[model samples]
Target: MTIGIALLTLLHILIPIYWLGGDLGAFYSSTFMTDPKRTVGERMMALKILNNIDMAPRTTLILAFPTGFALAWAKGWLAVPGFAVVIAAVAFLGWLALAWAVHLNHGGGAGIKRLDIAIRYGVLIALALTGIAGVAGDVAIPFFIALKLCIMACCIGLGLIVRRQLVPLFGAIRTMTSTGPTAETDAIIAAVNGRARISVLTLWALVLIASFLGIATPV
Candidate 1:
């Protein structure tokens, strides 16, 4: 039972990191083109990639939370109210973020933006809380816990940097799809493409780190 629970917990933790990291890479690659020569279809493809990438994190979160809770329960760690609350909160927020993103894709831009901000902040808080709990419990695998926290921080930071670059990309896409592109639009597209590539590479590095930490440390 212990071993089974440990495996499940590890799955819950690692799957999200893998899915999010991979999707981020796909999105980044698809968008890393500033060439004004690219067709609208190509740009749309890039957007689709971005959307898919955005979907992974939420899906992983969904899987991670309940499995984590179950593992914690099996290990008798969920006995603490604070831990329970944190798990529940993280799960709820993850679900909410997923729902909001879906809604945004359907045209709820403001709602999506707000939810994105909320989820980022909430995840950060949850990581901090989880790290504290891990330390308090003196889990034999403190390194994994610390690594998870660090990955969360890195993810949040990258998201913030990418967010700033998104506006211009959006505008460029709009101009490309609607009116013919201007020099300004060309610049925006280039910037967006460059940033997207960087974000993809960054996500890849994060995934590598996550994989190392997850696999190196025995649960």
Candidate 2:
């Protein structure tokens, strides 16, 4: 039972990181890389990747949250106020992400942009709180805490990079639609796609590393 509980806790931490990181990559590619300069085949491929990316994050979160709660309860960490707040915040963020996913699937006119922003901010806050609580509680080893902090920093850095790359892509895409593709548009599209690929690779690497660390020494 104890081993099983530890496995669950590790999964709770690792799965979310993988899912969210992969989905962010796909989102960046699909939305920002669509260009008239690209062939229809290329555009279709990007869309397919985006579609596949949607499922992982939702599935991971669905499993992670409950398992997380169970792990906390079993470990007696749920009794801590700071830990409880962090858990609750994660639960709320997971719900919002789910709602946004559903809305997008249904073609509902919901503010997905707002939800995206919320998820990013919520994740940063939750991770920061978790790190602080871990320090105060001495629940995790120093190496594990350091690993989690690095993963959290990577997550935030990815978001910032995506925003920086996407803003120019957004403008370029708009111009392509309204006025047709130009040299500037082509350049931005290529740059955005390159940055997005880098971001995706980075996230995948982070997820793998974090997952290993989480399992090797779960908190």
* Best prediction by lDDT: 1
Once fitted onto the true fold, the runs of candidate 1 whose alpha carbons sit more than 4 angstroms away are: 1-10, 13-25, 28-35, 61-90, 93-104, 107-112, 129-141
Can you write out model 1's per-residue Cα lDDT over 56-173, one digit (the tens) per residue? 6545534544555555555654465547756675766666666656545754577666766776677667776666666566544355655655575566667666767777777677
Model 2 residue runs over 4 Å out of place are 2-45, 48-69, 75-90, 97-112, 115-119, 132-146, 178-180
Q: What is the Cα-based lDDT of residue 152 in candidate 2? A: 60
Residue 137's lDDT in candidate 1: 64
- lDDT per prediction? 0.63, 0.62
True-vs-predicted CA distance for residue 66, candidate 1, Å: 5.5
Question: How many residue pairs clash in all the candidates, one count each?
Answer: 0, 0
Report clash pairs, candidate 1.
none
Model 2 residue 104 CA deviation (Å) reads 1.0
Q: Model 2: how far is 42 from its true place, Å?
A: 4.9
